[model samples]
Target: MNGFTRTVMRTVLQAIPTILGIIVISFLLLYLMPGDAVDAIAGMSGSASQETMDALRDTYGLNDSFIVQFFRYLGGVLTLNFGTSISYSAPVLDVIMERLPSTMILMLTAFVIALTVGIMVGWAMAVFAGKWPDRLLTSTSLLLYSAPNFWVGLMIIVIFSARLQWFPSGGAETIGAALTGWGWFLDRLKHLVLPSCALAAFFVAIYARLTRAAMLEVLRQDYIRTAAAKGLHPMLIQFRHGLRNALIPVTTVAGMHLGNMLGGAVVVETVFNWPGIGRLTMSAIAARDTQVLLGILLLTSVVVIIVNVIIDWLTTLLDPRIRS
Candidate 1:
């Protein structure tokens, strides 16, 4: 087949073993935890009898050997069955799918904000390296990078949300607003603003720093000097030549962060009370719902793999050297 299709196919093939390993590890880790789904169900019910608890354990095959349980779960997973969630009393896959959209929107918004703003800020920082502007922005990035995620969300809620009343404090929508068309879009965008910013804060700092460094390095290359000697406009040289190549490294780093971005969502979702996989994950953890938890982890791994595959494809398209 063609090169692009082959590359993507190769990536998918390589990811199969990795996904399997993740599945096995995730299952074992959850299995080793103090309690199982049965315990969570029992505790939530307040007074489940020992007999009932034993029956649950038996029904779920919890009493089986670790090897037996693993194979059973693996068999189900291979067939696209994620079992059932003890906490929600629903199929794990179904529950995850219901919440996936909210999480995807939040993360995508955060990623866009982080990447776009960061590249611009970093370009500026590189252009004025060692100057006051660079110093000020550098300090700002450090502060933002150092801030705890939850605290960032809270402060934003306190200031922009609680004090200024500029945006909705939490949730994915205005609830009973019954908004439609552009009206619905704007309302959802408002609710998305604060949490996205909070989630993006640290990543913005990271991308900004990486881009700044990559820009500096790219600007020093012989091609950049050649372009400048050709009397190209300063902005054209800075962006078209410099930032274009500089983005190669930034893209690489961003690909690696795809998985982590999902993890970061847990805090942001919890803070804003946003309905998403991250929030569902927290709920699953609290209830020790291994089935739902496994489902989320598997879905997250799949998403990360898919995104990284796309990133890898983009990297080749961006850098001719890699393509060759």
Candidate 2:
């Protein structure tokens, strides 16, 4: 009934079309991709009789007309039945659910690190504008932004894992460690550090730059000058007034980056051999597991839409003028 509630409801309603479009486009693209899933399966087994291939195609409904098959898949998706994976012999949803936790952990850890460090460094840059500190921070952030995540991941592995033996080279946890309680928690944290750093590197640069720019612009606003004239503590003016307004742009960027990371931490996950959805997606693509691929795409699309909606709501909350 309230304005905010109506806004949230309207946003959700709007997202339905986007979700449908994602499904339609992803399905059509994958459907139009060359080579049949049956053929890929057969080839994996080093050639099969023509009859066997034919039977396989028929068994998987690959022999159906394109429209018929597409509608059937769409109907299943509407019913929360993503079908079984051709390669894994498991339900697509189940397979994705199993891997989802690992990916969420990695992405969330990376997000927190990026947001915290980026905000702090950016705030520092704003505070020290036109000085050596600002110049150094700006240059460092640019370098981080330009560096590739996979390369950063590999270098971290080399230094921390191979050279220093400080952390496991790759994986969610040690293969056979009998860790429990705090021990298990610590092990997971250790395995998480390098990948998180690698994944967060580029995002840190992006957030830092955006935040610094936002802060600079915000600091020049009339209200900021008024606050300064009112004899409020300098730090209070910066943190309470300036930072609040600056966060609007940062929130938008953070939401977009979070959505992207959810869809795929492909490079970082692959480099670190983290058993996340991104690695699973790579395997599914390599094997031409259409069902699994579609499932991942759908899940990712949903996450992205949800994240953006939340960001919109947050923005409205932060700056009431956006509700207009």
Candidate 3:
């Protein structure tokens, strides 16, 4: 009925083909890999009879023709009836959902910290361009961007966790802590500190650099000079005017990355043993659980579409010129 509704509908409709493309490509790639879930199961079991493997494939419909399997899987995806995961012997959807909350929490904490701190630091860099502060921040961001995330995570754990004993070494929570209420939330927060930092580090570098460039470019514009000529407070002029407009590029990159957020967390999740979707995805990959892998891919594409829609709405809200 309204413009935003219309935009959302149009976007969803347009995304249908994209989602289909992702599904087709991922399915073909995974299914075409050297082995299927049957082989993984057999290998893990030490060995299996030829007939046993055949029957297992048949049970999972893995012996179907490629076209048949593709359509069958696609149909289930469309209907939200994602097939069972071989590794877990459970519905793929249910299994992913079980681990989704932890990933979501980790992602939310990392994203918020990255965007907020990145923008603030970027603003500072722009304000102090060519100075010691700018050089320092730039060097720090470059360090974060260059370092391997898993390595960063390991170092953080060694110092803060293993040595200092400030937080648990790794995990979503204390095993059998039986915490609840604020205590429960606090414990979760403590566990989150290391992983979130590791996950956010790369993104923070990216956003900070992007924001710095965009802000610097924006501040050079005529309007910024005009605002300065009006004798506005330096901080207000730098942040309120320069930073807001500069957010376009930062927001664009952030939205583009929301889709891959879960995937990127795999390294951090693995390092921290966080029991999230990323860890589950790693297990699925190791086991070659095509059904679970496909389910995760499909969900990721859906998340991309949904996040883009939200980002579009927010962008238009932030910059009213886009609404027209």
TM-score of 1: 0.98
lDDT of each: 0.91, 0.88, 0.89
> What are the TM-scores, per candidate, against the unseen true structure?
0.98, 0.95, 0.97
Best by TM-score: 1
lDDT of 3 by residue, 226-278 (tens): 99999999889987899999998888889888865676798889999999889
| TM-score-superior candidate, 2 or 3 | 3
**Where is the poorest 10-residue window by lDDT in model 1?**
1-10
- Predicted structure 1: lDDT: 0.91
Q: What TM-score should be assigned to candidate 2?
A: 0.95
Residue pairs with backbone atoms closer than 3 Å in model 1 (clashes): none
What digit string (tens of lDDT, one per residue) describes model 1 on residues 45-161? 888999999998998788999999899999999899989887787898899999999999999999999999888899999999999999999999999999989999999999998
Q: How many Å off is the CA of 113 in candidate 2?
A: 1.3
Deviation of model 3 at 108, angstroms = 1.4
Error of 3 at 225 (Å): 1.9
